[model samples]
Every structure is written in C-alpha cells, then in structure tokens.
Target: MVPTSSSTTDRVETFRLGPFVVPRIWTGLWQLSSNAWGSASVSKIRRGMARHVESGYTAFDMGTINFPSFDHQLIPRTAADHYGSAEIIFGQFKRSLPSPEQIVGATKWCVFKRTIPSRAVVLAAVQERMERMGTTTVDLLQFHWQDYSDQNYLSALRTLKDLKAEGLISAIGLCNFDAIRTDEICTSLGQGVIVSNQVQFSIIDTRPLHGMADVCEKHGVKLLTYGTLAGGFLADKWLDEPEPDLYSGNLTPSQRKYLDMILKAWGNWSLFQSLLHTLRAIGDRHSGLSIANIATRWVLDHPFVGAVIVGARLGVSEHPDDNQKAFGFTLSDRDNEEIEAVLSQSNGRTIITSIGDCGAEYR
Candidate 1:
C-alpha cells in the first residue's frame, strides 16, 4: 500500500544541489523498467507522480544504467532506451504541471563498454537525454563507469564539465563511484565540479563510513544514498519470520541481492532478527514509528548524506506518507547507542574491505 498523507505541513526536507534546492527524499523511478519489482499503466504512474508532488516529494531519479548485454543484438540502443520509458513518462508529467521547474529530474549516463570518452560522444549522450526528457537543460547528470582499469571516465567528466558550462547540464554527479576515484575526479576537475555521488549506504551496509564519508567531508561532496532499507528487509514484516527460499519466484531482484548480503556478507539470519528487534524497540521509543521509518531516519541522520532515494513502484506500491515520518524527529543519543549495540555484532564495519568498497559489487 502507498503511504497516504493528509498532513498540511510540508515535512519533506530540502537540500541544495548547485543553484537548485530539492527534496532530500527523492522518488526513485528504477522500478518502472522491470516487472520484477511490479508494474503499472502510464496513467496510474502519472497519478502516482502527482501524489508525490502534492506531498512535497518533488525530486525524481530517472537515472537508468544501460547494460548493452541486456538489449537484443539486432536493435540499436541508446542510453535512454534502458530506462523503460521513465524519462518520457516524467517529461509528460512535468509538462502538465504549472511550474515544472519546481521538480528536479536527475538522469544518468553509465558507460559499461570500453571506449574513449570523446567530447562528441559525451555531447551526444547528454543530447539524447535532453531529447527524451523534452528539456533543453538537464537538472543533474550523474555518470557511471564500469571498468576502473580504463581511465576514460576522467575524460568523460571533463567533457561533462564542459557541457555544464555550456548550459546543457546544470550539475555533474557520480554514480556507484568509489572513494578513491571520487577523490581523483574532484581533485583533477577542481572544486564544485562534482556536486554529489549516488551510492549504496545503509546501517547494514556501513561501507560508506569507512573512507567515503571522510572524502566527502573533505571535498564538500554530498552522498545520495540508496538501499537504506536493505530492499525492505529492515522492515517489521520480516521481523519474526524465517528466511525465504532464494529460489522462490516471489522475491524481486533487489530482494535477492540484498538477501545475499544479509545472509552471507553482513551477518547471519539470526543476527538480522536481532537487529530487526532492536529497530522495532527504537521505533517504539520514538512514539510508535515504523521500523522502515526508523531505518531511513538512521541513514538520513548522517551529515554527509544529502538524501535517500527511496524506490516507488508507482501505483503498484509506495510509502510517501510513512516515508515523511523519517523527518520531524531527531534520534536521541540513547537511540543510537541501542542501534549500535546490534550493529557492533555484525560485519558492518569490515564489509568495506571484504566487498571492496561502495559500488564494488557492480565492478
């Protein structure tokens, strides 16, 4: 069920991105592409978008990573093709609004193939996104590179910086980039070149705290985090239940991925149950908040985190109202102590070295 909001007050917080101020809780559109998460009609999706805007969740993530292997061999594909009409859908919804500028649409350009990132190639990529979104200027263009061995990603950032200067892009960001590369890009390009880095950061996956946090604090770069809820495993639904069969078709791709992390990398199922119990107790202390809300709050409480990109399955499922509960309350020192008591038992700290840093799974 989607979280319904009737509260008049605007509790969704805002953060600065270049010259624009946007909601710290952004609506992620990644679910639009695959039926593995679930799907809805275009009209219903647009209505869902309207509900989010009405509730002050105006920021959207239209950044779809394009993997060439997924596409058919014969059909020619562009980066926008992988989004499954997300950009087109957002374009229509934004145009329908009286003040479209109030909404922030952040798209991405992910390079998985090995090639030289020439100026022309980068310009074409940006232009393709502009064409699909029906906007002359992109709000934020986040770039991702698959192979770190190939150093062409720097060349790409240089070209994107030029595009930002030319007004084709408002700001440049990084997606799934590690702390070492993030520092290199920012240092080579100078200050203010990189506005944000989108990565996976959650209480269960505390890899960002290892080194990424220090680098961001040093360079004044903000982190746009996802997987904060561990694909919904951190919620109360799985609190007392036994682990699901991985072969079960009921699990979404996100669920399977995160389940592996919980069972193998982070901790055992018994330890996860203990963590859930701890979160439930914390939520109870906070005037009966939900476990999901408490987990999201824990991530948002970090000073280096700019926002948490919560996934919305459009009309299929959402939690806009419940998600807003993450704000309006500060976690007490006692709350953190109780939470850390559970985390101290897990591999949260060492997951960085074992997993090879943030976004290392993809590489």
Candidate 2:
C-alpha cells in the first residue's frame, strides 16, 4: 500500500530512508535562496523553518550553501538566529530538537562548476556542506549533474558510496536523474546503495511514472517529488485565471520555469484551467480540501513516491495546517479517473514522449 501519514497525527507521517524514518512531506528551502523565489529576510527564513518543524515537518531539503549570497548568510549569527527562532517556535509548546539527528537535513552534491570532480574534491565538497549546515553528517546527500554526457556521474556515486561507508552521509541518492540513468546507478552501486531519487513529479508532469517508477520499485529507491504543486500553480488561486506572461514581475524564477513547462509540456492555459477546475471539484467532495491538498495527495498516493518536497516560501507563505490535511483523505478510483480524464485531454498525456523521462529536461 502507498504510505500515508499517521491517522492520529497526519502531520507526523514517517517513512524509512535507509535506517532513519523521515517525514513523508519534507520542507524545502530551495526558495529560501536569494532571488530564486524572491527575497526572504534571514529572520523570516528562520521563523518559517521553526514553524515548519513545529507543525511536524522535520525533514528539510536544501542546496544553496555554496551560492555566493547564501554562503555569506551562513555565519554563526545566522545559525544563532535560527536557533533562537526554533526555540521560540517549539520551546513553549513542545520539546525542540536537541541535535541534528532529531531533524533530518538533506542537501545535494552540486556539480555546477564541473560535471565530475575528483574523488578528493567530491569528498571536500561534502565536508564543506556538512560544516555549513552545522552537522557532522548529512542525513541524505542527493547528487545532481548538469550534463549527462559525462560518464563520471558513476565515479561520483562511487565516491559518495565511500562517504556513506564512513557515515559521513547516512544515505546517498540522486536528484533529476532519468530512469535509464537511475537503473544504471542501481546496477553500478548495487540495489540498496541508493535510497531515493528526487525529481519533478506532479499532475502536470508524470514522467516519473512512465519509466522511473518501474526502476525505482524494482530497486527499492523511493521517489522524492518536487513540483508536486507545480511551483504553486496547481492551487485554487490559479483555477480560472488567465495565463501570466513569461516576464511577469510577480513570477519568480521558479514560477517562470514551471509556467513555461505548463505552456510547453502541458499545453495551453485553457487546458491547465480545465485541469484546475477538475481538481477543484475533487477538493469539494473531500471536505472542502484545497486544490493544493488534492494535488499533493494525488502524488502521495502513488506507491513509488516516499515524500513530496513542498517549498516553504519561508516567512512569506505558510501552509503547514493545510498541508496536514493532505493525509486526511485518499483519492478514490473515481477521483483518479476524473483527474486522468482531464489529463488525457491535456497535452500532459503525451509529455513522456514529448519531453522524455524524469530529469530529461536537464539533459
């Protein structure tokens, strides 16, 4: 059966990531970076993180430590600020996490400068990231590559496997890796070495189900999905709205990118609106659940997916209460058929062939 959050505390659903049981819905800090999703002050970021933890989100996904602005922002003072904020958010209401192990921190092995670095250089990079996050070992170290032509991704994973052996990273996984590549990794590293594959999996993009799902299910690697909400475009706010232009000031880099995916991969604005309206109808039947909740639950119901990475727009937007409702219900066969009915008519039906498999856009 597909994993769901606990019936008593939907906010606290946990799944095994290797030996660690982590939150089913992770709080993503990709938006916490500078200008990527707009400017969020440090104080706001800290409070938002605390609130996310207070609301039972303990798994945190981030990868901006090496960014120029974020590197400067990772001083002792910033850590102190977040420590204080977390104290306030959970100290009075409940016991706060005393150590890094209490809250899972997952970061990426970024290969921005080079497609593949020497094993020593890769080890050094992981060490630097661990220091910046103020943890000795990262719970999950997800790797991403800019170019697929470089076969050195295999060597990189081999290095990560060595690091995992030493307990520097509790688990190793991939980010934006296609199904074929994922299967290759499984063959290269053995079945249980890779724990999860983080990729874009949403109503607008179900490419993971086309091939990645089979490989992951066979190899036992869970799929951690980003863009399940399609950069916030899958919610009720955009239900019947007209399409915003590419250069719209209100759209952040993330929104623009995902909006373009909708335009290119999912067809025109009207088809997207039809999908939204259908999601709204589904939400109406489920105790007035928001469109976001329905969209997220649909992804969660897929047996191959272990968690969904919903962006925590730091202090700007908070949806902890509403997110908790995602585990409150299941999408019935009727609901799936209704959603697929709209999807079949939309261009998303042909996206697998149009765009290729998961992470195909990057390649």
Q: In order, how many clashes per candidate?
A: 0, 0
lDDT of each: 0.85, 0.75
Best-fitting candidate, measured by lDDT?
Answer: 1
Per-residue accuracy of model 2 over 1-363 as CA lDDT, tens digit each: 112245434546678988788878988776644455655666666667767766778777773222211111222222111122222322222223445356777777656434447878888878866666656676788887756777888998998999889989899989888989899988999979999999888999888878888998999999989889987899989987888986787787667777887887688898889889989999999989999999999999988999998887777776887888898568999999999998888777578787767765654
Consecutive 10-residue window with the lowest summed lDDT within model 1: 66-75
- The digit string of per-residue lDDT tens for model 1 on 263-356 reads 8778899999999998899999998999999999999899999999998999999988888889888788998998899899998889887777
Show the lowest summed lDDT stretch of 10 residues, model 2: 66-75
lDDT of model 2 at position 46 = 66
Off by over 4 Å in 1: 1-9, 63-81
